[model samples]
Target chain A: MKLNIALLPGDGIGPDVVVQAVKSLQAVADAFGHTFHFEEALVGAIAIDKTGDPLPEETLAVCKKSDAVLFGAIGDPKYDNDPKAKVRPEQGLLKLRKSLGLFTNIRPIKAYPTLIEKSPLKKDIISGTDFTIYRELTGGIYFGEKKISEDGTIASDLCEYSEAEIERIAHLAFKATRSRKNKLTLVDKANVLETSRLWRRVVTTIGKSYPDVELDFLFVDNAAMQIILNPSQFDVILTENMFGDIISDEGSVIGGSIGLLASASVGSDIAMFEPIHGSYPQAKGKDIANPVASILSAAMLLEHFNLKEEAETIQYAVEKSLEKGVVTPDLDKNSTYGTNKVGDFIADFILHAE
Target chain B: MKLNIALLPGDGIGPDVVVQAVKSLQAVADAFGHTFHFEEALVGAIAIDKTGDPLPEETLAVCKKSDAVLFGAIGDPKYDNDPKAKVRPEQGLLKLRKSLGLFTNIRPIKAYPTLIEKSPLKKDIISGTDFTIYRELTGGIYFGEKKISEDGTIASDLCEYSEAEIERIAHLAFKATRSRKNKLTLVDKANVLETSRLWRRVVTTIGKSYPDVELDFLFVDNAAMQIILNPSQFDVILTENMFGDIISDEGSVIGGSIGLLASASVGSDIAMFEPIHGSYPQAKGKDIANPVASILSAAMLLEHFNLKEEAETIQYAVEKSLEKGVVTPDLDKNSTYGTNKVGDFIADFILHAE
Candidate 1:
């Protein structure tokens, strides 16, 4: 099979980590007898510096024409601390999602057995905690109508959702549930927000069609508590954009490090895979930021294309790297291995794996 | 001073808990040289059964005329499970909050030295985790314009915030920081929600007035993570209604149990105190529910009225009760004390204290 991949190594440690993802992807392509072509594009602060547009149209074009886009990370401290700046790095990523029709963000929070002890939570609470969050990416308040009054005294964001919008993501989540534990928990604020009520109504209606999947609803507040109290109770969590954003990050803490999680933004035809971690601006040139998340994102990209064997090989390599302690300083601060070394180790593991 | 306190012992464990709070309040009044008048009112499922209105006019009148209100738990399994039921118990609580103009909800999360071991998080993470959350009670999506399209295909809740709305609570939170460590973290979804941007602007503008207090803004998602990752970093958390609801519940996990936390919803004149825990309908008739939260709430009420020594006495009594293993089954299943017994023990401790 031939795949066209657009590579967006946005800013800071993005370039460093994307290098590892590409290396791992190359190993997968070589081992699986597949042809994978890559095209490079700029986004975020880098794009803004070069082209004066955070999301250059040329970058969007490359993503549109590709089979899958492999994203590194976005954001820079300069853009982050400067609230007065009109153009920001995050806007580029949000725009990319909107432009590419990547509406469903799947963040799988699976705690690795080797790293369970690293979690701040008790081993019993953190162990066997595996769940995926299906976050509705395009709709809700993220893209809602934003207004600032002339006097700047009032600001409002409209949280709107169409029935169709809720239905599309709910269907994907339910399907994922059938393939896993067949349990779906829809997290929403149905008691207060009409959008949440709409989400609950649509998801419940769609749930009837998938009888094998058990469905439960929780108010967002209770859901947040339950995530920390009993994470094992969830299998597939479905929520709107804003709730999903908060819940997914909370889920990241369960894994011990946000640097270890990978995400996939999927639409009907195209999907984009990336690490859940942000660009570590301080570690940009230090060669010490973790690249495992980016490499694992490449694994997710392969799985997205139904290349199960290739994806498993990449995951096995990551596990082997962990077992051998060939990790970046983020995982083991005393370790001598740097970002490139970790990437090289992972790529080598994939190549030599059975 | 003479004070009329409206007591609403709503449902399940409500009566048991309120009894203890009233007893503690009476003790405080006796010790502090104040006259306390108590009035009881029905609410939640019990109110629906008797008056067919959760916040009956009579109940509202009693609350309005009172100097302050002491609220017990609301909601029952019977009403909670029947989502289709029109007159639910939550409505009463929501209506009460709106009617009383209880717009600022103050919830303090602190780990007791005796109960720190109960936390799922590591001791290091939970050790210095003392912070207060100020939740805006009456605005944002909770009271926004909710609409369902005539065809039932679309639903939306407008998340609107005026400058005055955010300014009122932001100022209060800033004042709180002045008394604490003088650091405030404003949690919002400014990157996505227009309301959040408005919130950031208003809070940032207000922050300038309190130059001694260091103010920072965090996305709600990141705030949720940081709450568990490094809870001590926050002094006072200021947020809108819905975000506050979720984050504060998440905050409970760090303290070990929701039953161990208390909250105060304050208006200009009227204030309501309640335990953050929901009514455990299963433990309704059983004597297992913990009364520490209610007892502690009464302590807070004392502090509110400038009865600092009396408040400290209640707190000391609660700590002694926990230290001596005189707690409800929820706190220690191995212990033999019941709810009423625990309350009796604490009250006894307070009265006998030298």
Candidate 2:
């Protein structure tokens, strides 16, 4: 099999960690007898500095023509502090998603056995916790019509949803449930919001097609509590833009380290995988950032193409690294491994580990 | 001082726990030598059964004439399970808030020294966690105009905010900080939503009036993670109704049991205090429901009327009860104390404790 992958190592530690992910992918290609072509593209702060746009036209073109896109982190402290800045780095990723028609953002949250002690939650609560969040990325309040009164006293944002928007994500989430735990929990404020009621109505209709999966509902507020109290109860959580933004971030805490979380954003034809952590500007060129999330993101990209064995190999390698204490300082302060060393170890494991 | 208190013990265990709160309030009146008059009103499922209205007209009138309202829980499993129930028991509370002009919902989440073992989060993560959430109750997406398309496919809810709505809650939250750790964190999605940006702008302007209190900001998503990561860092969290609904419930996890959480809804001239937990129909007549939340709410009611010493007395007694293991089954499985027994202990402690 041959795959053309567009690589956007955007800003700060993005380049450092992304290089490690490339090494792992290269190792997979060699070990599994597959052909993988990589094309580098500019995005985020670096793109802004070079071409005055956070996402250069060539970068979007590169991504559009590729089989898959592997994204690194975006954002910089310089661009972050300035509220008055006309162009921001975040808008680049947002534009990339919109331009690529990426509608579904998938995040998998799991408690790694070796890192259970690092979690804020007790072992009993966070243990056996494995859940995937299917968040609608493109629609809802964030992209809705925004307005302010002439007097600058009243402001509003419309949280609108169409059947098409709900249907696409509902199908994805239901499919996910069949592949994993056969349980899907739809999180919404249906009793209050018409949009939520629409979500419930649409998702319920879609659930009829997947009779093997059990579907249930929870209000956003109660869902927030249940996530903390008993995270293991959830399998695949489906929600809209805002609720997903809050609960997924809340769910991230169960894994103990933000550096180990990976996310995938997909449209009809294109899917992009990236680390959930921000580009730590201060860690630039330090060789100290964690590369596991980036490497795991590479695994997600493989799974997107239905390369299950290849994805599992990468995941197993990551787990082995944690067990062997070949981790960055964030996961183990006594460890001497840096970003490059961690990537090398995972790649080495992929090639030789039995 | 003389006071007229309206007591609304609506349904299920609502009457059971509310009677416990009344016990503490009566204990305070006796010890503090204050004249008090109590009037019971019908609301929620019971109100629907007796008067065919969730919030009876007479009940609203009683609440209006009172100095303060001490409310119990609402909702019944029968109403909760039936989607076709036109008059939900929950509507009673919503109508009550709208009628009384209760614009701010205040919830204080604290990790009690003795109850730290009960929390799902590790002791280090939850200990010393003391923060207050001031949620704007009446405005934002919950009350905003909701629309369903003619064909019933598209739906929308407008998340609108006025400077007046933000100002009232901001003032209450800022004033709260002066008495707290002198830090105020305004949670909003300013970068995305127009309403959130308006919130930031209005709250930033309001922060100038309270220079003694330090003010900062956090995006709602980040705030959700921070609440679980490092809850002690926050002093006061002020947010819109929807964000508040989510995070406040998330914050409740740090204190361990929802049965111990209390909330107060306040307007310009009137305030109502209630336990945050819902009425448990199974525990309606079982005498097993935890009464600490209801008793703590009575403490908030006293504090609302400038009866600080009375409030402290109730708080101290409740803490003593927990310390002595005089708790319901939720907090301590080995404890044999029931709801009434626990309330008696707290009332006795209020009257006798040094």
Candidate 3:
């Protein structure tokens, strides 16, 4: 297969990590006998600095023409602290998501056995924690109409969901359930909130077509506790934008290191994979930040294209790297390797996969 | 001191636990030389079964006449599984909160030294974790206007908050800062939701009055992660209704045992104390349910009345019981003590406390 992949190495440690991801991908392409082309585009704060536009017109054009996007972290402390700034790095990413039609975000949290003891959670409890969270990106409370009174005393955000919006994501989650564990837990507060009720109603109706999948529901509050108490109970966790935003972050803690998680934001037309961590401005040129999340993200990008064997190859390499302790300071403060060296080790492992 | 207390043992384990709370309170009364009047009221599923109303007029009257109300868990599987049932136990509790004007709910999560290993989290991460969550009980999406379109194609819940709502809870949490670590973390989705932005704006302004209490903010997503990652960093966490519900439950996991959590709901006129766990219908009448939460709730009730010494007496007794292994099956399966025996041990300790 031939593909054009757009690399958005936005800012800070993003460039460093994306380099690792690119190296791993290049190694994967060589091993799998696939033709691949990489096109670089400036985005986020770098784009903001160079062209005075966070999402340059040329950058969007390049992304639109590519087969998929491999997004690195975005955000600068300057932009973060300046809430009044009109043009920001995050806006650029949001616009790209909208333009690319990336409606759903898939975050897969797997507690690696080697790293389970590193987690704040007990090793016995979260050792086998493996679940994916399906969060709707384009709809629900985040994109809802926001209003405040003139006196700034009254403020409101409308959490709305249409049948179509619920059905699309529900189908994706239910269909994915068939490939993994048959249990799908829909987290919502249906007993009180109207939107949650609509979610329950829509998801239940869509669930009928997939007789093989066992459907269950939990109020968001209870789901929050369940995530910590027995995360192994869940397989595919489907929730709305706001609940997803919170629950997925909560899920991040189970893996012990946020640096070990990767995510895929996909729609019908285009898919983008990225690390779940943010741009740590302080770690920019330090060569100390973890590159595993980005490498795993590259692996997710492969899985998105139905390159299962290639994806598994990368995953196995990552596991072996972890097992061998060929890691950065984030995982081991006394480790010998830096960001680039770890990336090299992963690429080397991929090139010589069993 | 003299006080009148109302006991609402709603359903199932509710009765079993409240008996323990009452025993502890009676011990406190004996230890402190305080005159106490006690009243009992029916509520929840039992109320629904007997009176066809979840919140009967007499129950509300008894609560109103008391200085403070002690609430046990509510909810029955029969009412839970039957969605078609109009009168439910939860509705009774909701009505009580409404009629009593219980505007702010305070849940304190504390990891007991002896029980820290029971937590899913590592001992070092959550060893000294202790924080209180102040969740606005009467407002936000739960009480907001809810709607389903005529064709049922769209559903929405308006998450609205006024300056008054935020102010009342802010004052309570800020006041609490004086007794705690003097740090307050406001959890909201300010970067996305209008209500959260409004919260940030209001909290920022109100923070000026609390110059001594270090004020910080976290997006709800980050807050969720932070609770599991670094729970000790928080002192007083103030949030809206829904965020509070979810985050507090997540906080419960750090304590290792959900049955150890106690909560209080207060307004200008009245206050209610309860164990955070729900009625375990399966454990109903088995005398095997953990009674520590209820005993701790009774301690909070004393704290509400400014009986600090009295409250600590019960707390110390409960702690001693845990230390001596005089617990129910939930905390230690090998323990011979039942719910009533644990309550007896705690009460005996209070009676003999120096």
Measured as a fraction from 0 to 1, the native contacts recovered by model 1 come to 0.90
In the predicted model 2, the residue pairs found to clash are none
TM-score of each: 0.96, 0.98, 0.97
Each candidate's interface RMSD (Å, one decimal) is: 1.0, 0.6, 0.8
Write down the RMSD of candidate 2 (Cα, Å). Answer: 1.2
Judged by lDDT relative to the true structure, which candidate is superior, 1 or 3? 3
CAPRI accuracy category, model 2: high
The global Cα lDDT (0 to 1) of model 2 is 0.94
Proportion of native contacts present in model 3: 0.96
Candidate that scores best on TM-score: 2
Task: Indicate whether candidate 2 or candidate 3 has the larger TM-score.
Answer: 2
Model 3: per-residue lDDT, tens digit, B202-266? Answer: 88899999899999999888999888888888899999999998998888877889898999999
Scored against the native two-chain complex, candidate 1 gets a DockQ of 0.82
Ranking by lDDT: 2, 3, 1
Q: Per DockQ, what order, best first?
A: 2, 3, 1
Q: Please provide, for model 2 over A2-98, each residue's C-alpha lDDT reduced to its tens digit, 9 standing for 90 to 100.
A: 9999999999999999999999999999999999999999999999899999999999999999999999989987888997888899989999999
lDDT digits (tens) for residues B213-282 of candidate 1: 9999998988989988888888999999889999998998887866878889988788999998888888
lDDT of each: 0.88, 0.94, 0.91
Give me the overall lDDT of model 3: 0.91
> Which candidate model has the greater DockQ, 1 or 2?
2
